[model samples]
Target: MAFEPLKGLRVLDLTSVVVGPVCTARLALYGAEIIKLESPEGDLMRGLGGQSPTGRHSGTYLHLNRAKRNICCNLKLPDARKIIARLLETCDIVVANMRPQALARLGLDHETVTRAYPGTIYCLITGYGLDGPYSGFPTYDSVIQAAAGIPGLVAARDGEPRYVPMVMCDHVVGEIAASSIMAALVERSNTGKGTFIEVPMFETMANFVMQEHLAQHSFVPPVGPAGDQRLLSADNRPVRTKDGWIAFTVNTDKQVQAFLDATGKGDLKADPRFATVRARADNVRAWFAL
Candidate 1:
């Protein structure tokens, strides 16, 4: 048997690049009929890399757009707009990543879609949120990382701010957008009305930082630095072994004692500084050095 919950759901995906496409791809994997609408030149990701002439098989693109149907349309033209309006008339969901103003100019925004098709669920993904000061300003993964202070949080202890590499900001935002859409769908089911959602990558990541890492530092006295309890450690990456690497962690006192016993250093567990969680936190550098 196959696992697909969103079967029979029609998702019209007008997203390009990593963030937006990743969200719709999740829907596709759940057996939704994902109609990926591309521009006449096709999604720029098609020609992003590789030695092939068409460059249609970008590993990055293939990773996200596997179950979607490719459809090319010149959205700048009136004929293309007409075609989309017709499709939206019957489609259950419409997802796009265009900027807020640009979406309004094209008459493809949530308000327009709601008036035309009251039962359609329209979701828009943006670099920043739909409102606020930096709403219209352009942004990408790295830019969002810098703006969100994630890079600074992950930086070296005594070195300059460092980025968390791999465009994870966009990646996380995509997941949040997908989950938000599904939640909205659930509400629509109960109320028998359509819904509109605006998912801003920066806004989402900002909240993520607040909930996961900023909890302790949200006060003025400053319980501690604004960072993850584990990953933000200066030496949190792969550990060097006699041969290669082994990423290992002994988090709790019991696990720490296990490693200490194996290494014949269990006696240190009873020392004053290594006594409790607060002590361990206070002397983390010495603990890590040991």
Candidate 2:
């Protein structure tokens, strides 16, 4: 049998789309009992990602919502609200990825849930932070990718601003939210207190991008430029060989020396421009040309 870390925990998953569902799916996998709250019409993802045999459960939806119980509710109805309240009373955690205003209107916001169900961990996932110009703005994976400079980075390499061809922001933020929820649960276990966590897609994705691309711009009076030149280099892709292609990275001085020796250009290792990390970073284009 597999280990069930969350064997007795219950999660009221009020999120319908990718981010929240992804988070709860992970929790469910860890043995939490997940009640996936949907509407009378069902989640939008249920109809997305192509047709199913029953035409109700799309592959994407099925994969994202596996190992969970589904419940249909109309939050506008008083009876449904009572049912949600009852579920909230017993659940250890509640997660939602709806618009802030929509969540507030439905009385599912963090403030309302934390007050009503003391000690219940409330996790809210949003496109942007709660109080900003873009707060409450509708967003999807592609929009977040563009906003977080993904397309721009792609443009730097490919000459055209293109999405990363995947729902990267949703997946990354969802996992992050899952980790945050786990941390909150641990804290609750120790203190017997509830916690409210907000996972904002835009800010999270921005930090993700900058962690690598910030480069010298991470310092005041910028040492060089914002982006890592080696990563942004057009020649940084897989090298084409006679029969196939091989992908490799030469980051450290020793690795560069080894690559040079392997290519029978070991003499280049002694070159002043390629001798040190700083020098190589400064002359990355010339080094790539070599």
Candidate 3:
């Protein structure tokens, strides 16, 4: 038997592209019935993600939108409100990634939805928060990553800023949104009320970066620089073998000693610079170089 806890729940997916679709997709995976509402022109990722045999559904689109029903409606038309209303009447949740202004223009904003259907779990995934200066500004995954200091981390290591070669912000924020929706589901079951979840990509990803890179600078009296030296080390990468590449890590003294012996560098075990964890951390550059 399948673990379908959300089997009976209907999710009205008023989202397009990666972030919102990613959240609803996880809900669908957990057995929620997802009805993806698409514009007549369809999702931008349908064509933008990659090549498609039919020239409509790209691999990225298919992967993200899997196991969900779709509805084609032109929200610009007056009659479309009727369609949305009907859908909302039966939906247990509404997940949207559209900007606040755009959602308001379409009459699908959080306030409108919650006002009409107080029991609807409304999840809005935005690029920025509702009150900030950047709120409602146009943004995407790459922009969010850059805003979150991801490229800066790379620049610290390689002297050049670069994206992670994937829509990492979208994926991270989407999974977070899914977990948040699940938490809301739990809360609603107890309180008999829905939740308005706002997952801002910029804030969320920035917090993620800060959690790791804030380092010694997290305190008022800074002990050291902001970035983690070990993480920013240029040598912190997969090592090349004769046949292929191999990635491994040795943190504990025992593991480090074993690594030294295995790599025919047993002499380094007696070296003060790489002897202890503290020494390795203090000499991160030299430790990584070894």
After best superposition, candidate 1 residue 26: deviation in angstroms? 0.6
Which regions of candidate 3 are displaced past 4 Å?
Answer: none
lDDT of 3 at 58: 91
Query: Model 3, range 154-218, lDDT digits (tens) per residue?
Result: 99899999998999999999999999999999999999999799999998998888956789898
Worst lDDT window (10 residues) for model 1? 48-57
- The most accurate candidate by TM-score is 3
TM match of model 2 to true structure:
0.92
User: For each candidate, C-alpha RMSD in Å?
Assistant: 2.0, 1.9, 1.2
Query: If the candidates were sorted by their TM-score against the true structure, best first, what order would they fall in?
Result: 3, 1, 2
Q: Going through the candidates in order, what is the number of backbone clashes in each? A: 0, 0, 0
Candidate 1 segments exceeding 4 Å error: 51-54, 156-158, 211-215
Q: How close is every model to the real structure, measured as TM-score?
A: 0.92, 0.92, 0.96
lDDT digits (tens) for residues 187-251 of candidate 2: 99899999999999999999999955688888998998778788788888888889999988888
> Where is model 3 poorest over a 10-residue stretch in terms of lDDT?
48-57
Give the C-alpha miss distance for residue 16 in model 3, angstroms: 0.9
lDDT of 3 at 268: 90
